[model samples]
Target: MAHEKVNRTKFLFKIIFIIIIIITILSFSTEILFIPTSNNITTPITVLPPSFNSSEEKFLTYLPHSGFHNQHDAFINAIMLSYLTNRTLIMPPILTNYYPPWSTFHSLYNALNKSVIAKKYRKEHCYIKNDGNGENIDNFCDNNKYSKYDNFTMLNWDQLFDLSELKKHVKMVDRGYDFSLDNLISDFNVGENDTYLFIEDKRFEFEFFDNDNSTRQIHEDFEKKFLISDLIKIDKKLLHFASLFHINRIVLENQHNIEFRHLIHNTLIINNSKLLNIANGIIKKLGDKGNYIGLHIRIGDGIYIDEAEDNKILIFNELMNYLLESGLLRNSKKFFKYNLKECVSHNLPIIYLATDANDPRKNLYKFYKNIPCVFTLMDFSKDLENFGNIPSDFDEDTNLKSFYVPIVDLLVTAYGNFFIGTPKSTFSMAAVEINNLYHGKNALVALP
Candidate 1:
């Protein structure tokens, strides 16, 4: 009878334990966040970002804007700030040129290839339109492409970078297109009662300069500096910022803090296996590593086109000076006279040009005139894939190739023995970071 009583007691304890475990899981699942969600997206965005186990832990997120490199800078800042504030970082989706802000990766790529936007991107298929200027452009989708509703996509953080690596430093929640507060509240039971802090900057590009003495440089450049102490002290469940990185927005003062930020920057490597696989293959085929020079010329956008000649001259002068001085060119005077095939016969130094300019050989012949051994991505066109599904009738997808080539260019350039880039170019700066990671002390990426 006593044995029966003991067994009944054990069974009751087991039931109670199971009930407690269920309650614990349910409680942890009710996470909360306050932010802007996508506008009229077709697919339902689920709040799958891991919730904080502890009540004290909050989150830090910001608006991701501009091109990929600029958005990358924002992500770096987001993680650093999240670590500083002892909060989980809610990383925003990577915004590609075709993609709207906060749109996920797959959605962005798929829309670019499958939707009406695909017609616009594959410029060859679209009927060519001429502005008053003689140049024919492929901008038919200029109106509908920007609509967050129509061409909606989001790039999960892990697609570009390794979250496992990021998680090593700070806690992070993968916010894959879950931009809506309504969805967040529904998924995690976020209540209106929850304290929310939103730091929206009225300035065009907000910057947080953290320094004890605001120097003349800061006085002239920044409108005003926000107090770090005030930011840290704010007791809000969700702390958000706006336009954090236009030009290295936050500057860490303390040695520990600065090192931490640097570590995160170093940690932010291009871990996407597909990118590396393509890049590594190129690097191997581009001849043995550290034997060639990588040059990135940006002449397609903004002031770059206007100053293309000057850029060309500066790059030419720098390369000539470097090659002659470094003894890389055995016969400097004769190097230009010989043809590329002949240069190959002589085993001259290889100079790979990564540029936005169309038909670089015809448009910018001067660069090749000086360095006959110059090679562009065109040299390896067959090896590199378009990465988009072109229609059976369409022979070439120039637009899809255009979208992918920049990243490939960046990666390939980063592995070069020497890299020369266009000044004030964020893509160049990003290449420098990757170069530093690979070459470290030997990194010699010069901006002209």
Candidate 2:
């Protein structure tokens, strides 16, 4: 009887131990599953959405009113700002108003082959003309070749936010003749309720002897309140406010956000089949003859107003020297059976020149005419006809077609083996960026 009682007590102890272990496992499993749900449920109450409907989200919209490169800059800044704010981004149309002939806005799809915003955000998040209620004014979506954001609503910057509150939060900063980088960094402090920060373009304005000492002093006093040196410096702060409701106008003062720049470049897809075919045709044409050198000669409008001849010669010589030193034209005998001068006269090994000169034959073309293999958009004039009614001369006054010409030129330049572009030209910068991304070549900048 005593041995049986001992055996019974041992069995009871084993059952008790098993029950405790099962309880412990269940408790741990419940925590692992329920903790995340609890956090998600609490998030909405703690963090307010930046829109009228609590469920609807607000986004960053960029109004690009400048030229191609200026618009390109705005696009880059908008992407970074959107990432930092954790909000959807509204892609701006390529503003062609800078050129009088093409005075209408073109969709991002028309300008680029792919929609970077669509790739990154949900269908409802990104707002483009196709995504909103606006009519397709330019017929960019006639073929249904690109992505559409029809569900997204278009809201102007002023319409989305309280301008009075925005003005109060924005500390007007003025940095006269000399832009103080130090003062710009110290002025901005992110507040809990501060949803957005607007940095006026005039804050970083500096020109040659444009303002008086009295005006400069007043600007300096204003800087004491708030200031920002450039877009790069505030990257961290922007990232911090990204999760919250905040809109920031990127300070445009010669700063390159390389990380975001590369992201934008990689995301852009050239969706226009017509442009793609033209670009491919140029590549195939040059592929038959050895590698080609792409040159961007920017000589339109005010470019020639000051030291025109000198600038032209300087750029021309720079391109020639680069070709010679880089051994791109080292085997003259194989490509062209003549001396260097004769080779240039014959246009040997192909030199693809992309210029804005009204008459290529009259301007730099005269210098490169002797070269055995020099080609331009005029060479593929027939191919351009497939798109629509383009100007015979590819002139700036071809209405909507004016925008297409430069974009095609940009793609051709990017596809080349070697590229040399003029300094401070956004068109060249964009071409170079694409070249670097696609061809893995470092494009040379023609120093003047």
Candidate 3:
């Protein structure tokens, strides 16, 4: 009877153990079971406020040139627009962040935010292979590495939509307008409160401002509006009044032994510190023997590499001769004396920030090492960040996001603030303006 009891007890324990295993499997299955089927999938669309198309709501614009610059601009624009509108701007989940700079700049939806079902269709539809023709080419086309859609990876737009962050409240969208005043009307986020334009073109004229109906009221009745421009000819006085906040400024001052007003022809801002270090180092290396003068070369999109580089070198030589013969550097002798002592140790450096830093013409640097010149490399893979216990995903690019280069930050200063930069980048423009505003008539920061 005791042996029989032992067998029964062991059997009962096995039954319980099996039950527990069954329950654990069911729990995981339930998590995967909730994924919705295609028949029931619905695209997430924002419900706009009644004022969205009304003439009374404002249109805030956040424009960018493209690439990582566009990505950064989108985040910044969303933050500023949210602050202005005082409401959340809803976005559609049909856009991809990855595209050509121009294509991404003008995308109409945020594709990454779509539900898994929508993503299935997008992966099928947004392919160059699926260009609407049913020609399903499934062969292993080994020679097609550089084909239009061969290596295109999707952008992670979903990672950006945290409601807690101010910079992501605004949605990524395309402005439907080029010449039509209606394009301005459609871009307004009526219910959320503000409208923003991240501009790429200078197409709007005073005539483009239309006050038609309730649709036109937003542009007409803005409590605050801003027009941020990197264009060289933007009028500073007009922009300040036009913006709830305008980020550009101008200052007039003279310091050292030179009347800086005479030499203050034009300036651009530089915001990236690594870039600045590269530039500063190159200048120090090249122009260590004399006063250094800097020039930026931007070749046309279609130009040959050989021609552009040759032209740039010739131009540099001519400019140097002019500075000496015209007494430009000599008449303002003390200014250059200060520059020489501060910026170089051996030769006068000539820095070139080419769109394609690899232009074979940059080989000029090899020949002119004694005349030292530098180029800025935007890559920061070598720069390590503080990594204690952060998760791998967050730590992947930590050094880049957390690293602040003061040179880039200073670009937000006022115009003519003394420090200057090249015009090709808005980062530089902002630095110039901020420096001028902060210093407020002081000499440019002199490094030891």
Candidate with maximal lDDT: 1
lDDT of 1 by residue, 177-270 (tens): 5444445434433446554544443433334544555452443345656655556777776775654565446655656666666667667666
Query: What lDDT does model 2 reach?
Result: 0.46
Clashes of 3: 54
Query: For model 2, how does the per-residue alpha-carbon lDDT over 1-448 read when each residue is reduced to its tens digit?
Result: 9999999999999999999999999988764542211122111111222322223333344334435556555555555444433444444344342311211223321222123232224333433434323454233342243344222121122221122321221111111111122222233332333224343333233221111221323232122222222222333331211111111233222223333334345554455666677777766666521256777878786654464567677777876687678755444334434533444445455677888877786877554544445677877787777677533221222245555667888888766767778776778777777777665433322211
How well does candidate 2 match the true structure, expressed as C-alpha RMSD?
15.8
The TM-score that candidate 2 achieves is 0.50
Comparison by TM-score, 2 against 3, better one:
2
Per residue, candidate 3 scores C-alpha lDDT tens digits across 1-448 of: 9999999999999999999999999987864553322211121112332235434323334322233433433433333333223333332121222233332323422222122223233344445344333333332221242233232223223332233222222223433212122333434523332223333222221111111221322232233223221221232211111111111111111131122211121121233344445334433333421233433343443343446566556645665575567454332233233333343443333332323344424544532332333333232223212122222121232233222232222221122112224333444433433444445533233310
Poorly placed runs, candidate 3 (over 4 Å): 1-65, 70-77, 89-98, 101-296, 300-357, 360-448
Candidates sorted by TM-score, descending order? 1, 2, 3
Candidate 2 ranges with C-alpha deviation above 4 Å? 1-52, 97-260, 288-290, 326-347, 389-399, 441-448
